[model samples]
Target chain A: MYHLISDIIRQSEENECVFWEIVQQADADERGVSKEESFETMRKMYQAMREADEHYDPKVRSASGMAGGAGQLLHEYNETGENICGDFVGKVMEKAIKMGESNACMHRIVAAPTAGSCGVIPAVFLVAEEMLHLSEDQMVEAMYVSAGIGSVIAENASLAGASGGCQAEIGSASAMAAGGLAYLQGGDAGQIADAAAFALKNMLGLACDPVGGLVEVPCIKRNVAGAVNALTSAQLAMAGIKSAIPADEVIDAMRRIGNEMPSNIKETSLGGLATSPTAQKRIV
Target chain B: MNIFDVVGPVMVGPSSSHTAGAVRIGYIARKLLAEQPRKVQINLYGSFLATGEGHGTKKAIVAGLLGMQTDDERIPMAFELAKQQGVDVSFGEANLKDAHPNTAQLILQGISGQTIEVVGQSVGGSRINIASIDGIETNFSGDYPTLVVHNQDGPGYVSAVSTLLTEQGINIAYMQLYRSNRGGDAVMVAECDQEVPQHVMERLKQVDGIGKVTYLGMMGDE
Candidate 1:
């Protein structure tokens, strides 16, 4: 009986390693592809984003954008008063905030299908496509890559903001975003994994700490950061840089870190923003 | 395991009880009817009634009737989409006794001249509990092979029904028997591991103390 248990444990560890190997080995742009094929893939992603964007309510969109510290910046960009990239960043932030607010209100909204990190993926990919004039298929391919990275994080670490804090929600989102960016930029699968791993590692130990236990407050602002971080990490990986730890190892570390984090720092909102003097004055 | 215990990875948003559960209740209510409802009236109770407007609870119900999931991006525009699909919907509020907070009662008139009253609650994370059908107070969670029998309350009604199930080689996983009074009205709900045979239902309906035997039927994909 003991042998059977030990065998099961060994198999589990081996499976985990194998999963990491698969991620570390994939390359979105490992080899030369026909120009037409590349274009088709880009087109598909753009199409999905557009379709998905239409499903998002304008009210929710506006809310997310405002809350992400992007409302004014986006408005400035719309009027050509801000740099293009800065404006884009602001818009992404705004959308993230709106998503948080909507979730707090218990709105029947689609998460793309993730409510907590809803703003990050769409804001990054959709905005990038518009700015760069990328095709839909390309964007969709990146999204698929992001999904793989997200699954790894979910399996090895946690996606529940309450479990690990905002780090899990926004950090995981950033990792997914980083993978998407690297994949889109023609990086190999290993590079994409490396980028994702690095991005998550950077933001490990961040707290949830949303004010008033609402998905608003820092939640919205963090999503914008998540998007930016994803893009940056992806760029780094495309440049052939690697994270200090492998993707799987980083995920395990995140899990351990989460386990050690105080419960107040998680989504319970008992610490950080929740306990801030200003927040206390407003709610209590 | 109870179906509720199994949380599948659907393409749905977060908060399965709030969003996904509400959609399922609407879907079940639609399926239970003979056809698509021409006119629908929904009454939200307690928390559902209080915050439903903001949560898109109203839209979700309409969307579910129109055959949409909570994860569907088009849930927000469900009202417009429903109109295009020719479904008329209205919403109201009700106070329910001994009911879950996030509960709604729907009165649907199908285009095929059929009508059904559906009362259900969205428990959380998009999960729902169906409370009753057509005034028959039942406790079936829309899982398993459910037998919902609307009958008069009298002696031997339960035993007679149990005997039929035993004879048919079907084991009841759980049973909830509710009635207003001993000699008044009653509803018998049976959750079974296997489907009940047609002959058994017929026998139960013919029993001396039985009034009406209606099988609420099976739920959809888990």
Candidate 2:
């Protein structure tokens, strides 16, 4: 029914349906499956994300030997009440890192938009589960919101770091998470679209230069930034802040910037943080 | 973009382009070969050459040749699997003009002694584009039911091939016919909205002036 965020919002308002409901019906129609079946497929994807977290092995190191244990360390820091970001944010950071680390360790992950940015969505889901006590069904509904936002980004811009830089990977994930989090908090479709726009604007032009072309370095840690950006953007939108740029315009700008970006900085690992002295030495 | 495309293709990963997409390229190569791979030569290019090893690109591609899916936990053990499965695999670098950085050219020999050259690129997010097959230029996402026909450049050939699909009630979503030079050699690439069944493909092989007929359906364990 809708491919653009503006269209989706307009459809939601005109039809007097919730954001996820429109997406649910549309996805069902597109996939040629029943609404229940379509929703169940999304539920299964959420289940995989949850299970990935449940199966986290703290001792597991990525093949490059640089990714491991930060999640556990953050968990310990949070338990001691030393985290300055507050409990909910700390929990999200922890979960985000865990998910990113798991992906780097060659474990399975839902590449929400893309794999390097996989942790952002699940971080929001797992943390919201802990702090908000939302039901599994509530969480899955939020995923449709994310998916709607994600599809728009993937279409107008791209979901690949190689094609669109880290902005497309982390920025798209953050925007999706922001929109979904807004939905989770009972925000209207307009608010959801605004939240996504705000989140993506904040992340536009971010580079995708992984050190040694590995996902373990700056790649995994960037997940926290994406998750927190989502959290803050959602909070801002829910509190009545409006994005100056429309969601579609923001996505269009993202595509242009991705095209303008030098390929060396777009996941080729030839520049940016990938070329830092410390990163070079740390490359395994 | 399907929302499902946004949500998943849940896969084994360190890098989607290098690892997961590589697996798909290999799987497509295996499918294009039409039988178990007997021996395969893989030529990695650009970024695939620079960073693919760190991302398990080699192992992932081998796993795919073994008919493994992207999420198969056995991906890391693809080398051992190849040894046991009797698929001789070798990797080398490639220099191709105007190719994507994440490209690989697989020259494969299948168990039935059929050989094919498949060049594919891992665009992103475990999605791949089959850029060419058997050195004939054609483009199709392995996601669709694709028919590639290599034939002599002549009249009635394109009509003949498309007519066969039309007769089978298949809709052609995209169709292209290219010739090396006027009346020299030609290729036809057709991506269908529905599967163009085995019997139709067998019939395609019978068309006059046709040198090769290849079909790619969908990715599955079988």
Candidate 3:
């Protein structure tokens, strides 16, 4: 029953189990269910995430008629031979856009932390599984790892854009995805925490200013950015780079920054890019 | 927090707080009414009022009142479905004080001429809080099998309800009682560890001074 990432790490080292196993066991104990039952629930969630990612229809526009076809456009661009990010990164970006666009179109999606930032973890996990040929069991374990990181952040900081900003929404999702990716690559618990810390630190004050108070404009593109950031952070952690500040302290800083933020920069759609003339013109 | 709170609650959504959570608030209000409402007045507040239409908050609420789950793909067509079902629905804005941004006040009139007024808030991430019932202040998250009993604020009502639940082996996880005035109308909100059987509800309704008994099983519990 660890409420903090630091505690989960310490307990993992003490029990001589990987981070996912520790999380699995702790989840069973907390919910008073068997470990097998807990794993079964995660399996269902993973299946849902996979279904959303695979069933993308880029032609479906948001109900607000704000975002549509961008995911299809990105996929087409990636199919061309002129892409610079290579096939692996391109695939990651494609899945992220698909997930975000799917959410905007009112398709079923797992709120990996939240719906506005739902694309980050699924994008990282699905792309990693395809490129690395990981099994279903491995993907499920990675979800457990991601859940552990998200629980800590949600307890220590805020995950709602209304309470914090985009830094709390997409920022937390990026951190969770980074840590999960590190675990899937066989990094230690400390390295996983480091990856999360780096990813969160990089997005400390990103504002939440969805144009027209809708989750379609900057929110969709931001999911793609979060996925890429998670991949980079995981790679750095695997290479033994350490964050100067610990993971828990980084979450505390996020909470502090969220508290200091003005409500306009939160989910109110009053400031930042939401106030730009281009964004304001679409309010009608 | 459990793993589901982090990685799950599969829902159809452009926004969880606005769409999914709105569905839950409406669903719970329907349950509290104990029947399908003949007419409903939904008052969206704060962020729900400012941006609800674009996010389909109204449709989500109507879908929930029709007993649809959060992930039901039929949500987008809920307004039309309500018309087919003969459910009169109207939307308006409310100035709720000190409530969460995503709040809705539902006024439902049931077929039996009984009315229920519920104030619910979508805190975030598909979680909801039933902030008040009628004019009485109360609090309970709709995560458990809950029983809300409206009765006269006289002696022995709480004991009577708790005693019946105990006889059925239902353990109360949390309980709160709120009243408008002394010896006047009161409500008891009990969240139980296990499901309260239909017989228990019928038995409670038969108790002296008990006006209405509402059982809201966990979301999707039906």
Candidate 4:
């Protein structure tokens, strides 16, 4: 219901709890649905996200035969026990890859802001849940935090690659995940906002150039990177780091950057890696 | 934009606007027809026409016409499923004037020889706008329990429909009326907060000057 992050923060201040304020806003916006019912719906979504990760079959290729097996490869690599990111972050990467690959294969996924960036939020939340021993209710509350941040981004900027760029898609998603992760780690509203701002600020100029006009190459791997970025940004916020710019201003910058982005790179598959020699050779 | 708009829409997709939204357009078309489509011609427009094949928009449309939800895993086999279900499907391109990039015009013929043409636009994030029905301009997103009432252009129809909905205990979330000329045919689209029951639809069809009443229940899951 609140169109701006500043508005959400103000309302949270009034309510004395960011999570409840977001849930109350969601309840009002849904028209007659109570907060509990809204949370129940979110819980179902969380369940679906978890199921998508657990049921991922890396062997299954996409219908276009452009993507598949990469998630399994990542899983195997993580299993070698040589990953420098450690088991927790390695698992986040693994789930992100699985979710992105699943989406390319037309598997059921929750569009955390969008389908192309679906993996980031789920990957981050699932890993946080396991690593921190957070309860399902806590994860659901964290999703409310993510939803509030994402709605602000959607209203102020764009979430579609065609309209903005990968910056809006994956970048907004990483911000959402980062904010949610900060909340899960018991960060205050200011810290959560900082996490989101930091995550988005780092990804401002990212392009959306899916090779072959498919959400396969670069899209899947980009999701993995977004997940890690969310994790790192959350850790930074939890450690009392602040973004030089406010969260709302960072989102405004994202909107301006998205508006100035050339059409060729904004999901046209006509620029960036989409036009690379290797991608060009495989285009036919 | 609600929380679900951000965190959910649980869908099967390579792309939400291309695949999930395309399926929704076809699904809404089928519901408006109120029966299984015997023959359907889908006309893709702009970006949909340029990249729909790779995104499986064609298959998604067929799947939607067959009553498949957005998350249905059978989408890849939509063509085979349509063949098995005896639904004839064809595709082409359309030059829609002043329409969104992701638009599709579906011409469907029901088994009883009833035909309906729907021009719909998938406006990203699996959200859609049903722009026109049977060439008449009207707008309603398939997000609610919608009633599309075609009637003679007059004063009493809106009040009458409103009364009927009130009697049925259904609250109208939004209502819009459009007509070509006075006393000519008019379309009134009413999106209700509650689902319009079949009995209410039957009663609305019997209203004087009301030509056609089509009720599209809440679109099941994204």
Q: What is the DockQ of each candidate?
A: 0.13, 0.67, 0.80, 0.68
Descending-lDDT candidate ranking? 3, 4, 2, 1
The TM-score between candidate 1 and the true structure equals 0.59
Candidate that would win on lDDT: 3
Please say which candidate is ahead in TM-score: 1 or 3.
3
Per-residue error for A60 in candidate 2, Å, reads 2.5
Which candidate order results from sorting by TM-score in descending order? 3, 2, 4, 1
What ranges in model 3 sit over 4 Å off?
A: B95-99, B111-114, B219-222
Quote each prediction's TM-score: 0.59, 0.93, 0.96, 0.92
Can you write out model 3's per-residue Cα lDDT over A65-173, one digit (the tens) per residue?
A: 8877888998899989567988878888888888999998888999988898999999999989989999989999989998999888899898889888998989999
* Per-residue lDDT of model 2, residues B63-124, tens digit only: 98899888887898899999998888898987689898889999999898999999999886
Q: Return model 3's CA RMSD, one decimal.
A: 1.7
Least accurate 10 contiguous residues by lDDT in model 1 chain B: B1-10
Q: Pick the candidate with the highest DockQ.
A: 3
Pairwise DockQ winner, candidates 2 and 3: 3
> Can you tell me the CAPRI class of model 3?
high
The predicted structure with the larger DockQ, 2 or 4, is 4
- Tens digits of per-residue lDDT for model 1 on A1-284? 01111222234355653222232223223324453554444344345444444444434332122232244444445567454556666655555544444444344333432456666777777777776777765675666556556655665677777677777778887887777777667776678778888888889999988665555677656777888887778878878887778777888888899999999898666798879998777653
- Per-residue lDDT for B1-222 in model 1, tens only? 111111122323334444566777787777667367798998888756654553456777887777665556676677898789788898888657877877889999888777878899876334567788877676667666777776788777778778888887889999998887766778888888778766787877777667656553554422
Docking class of 1: incorrect
For each candidate, the alpha-carbon lDDT, in order, equals 0.64, 0.88, 0.90, 0.89
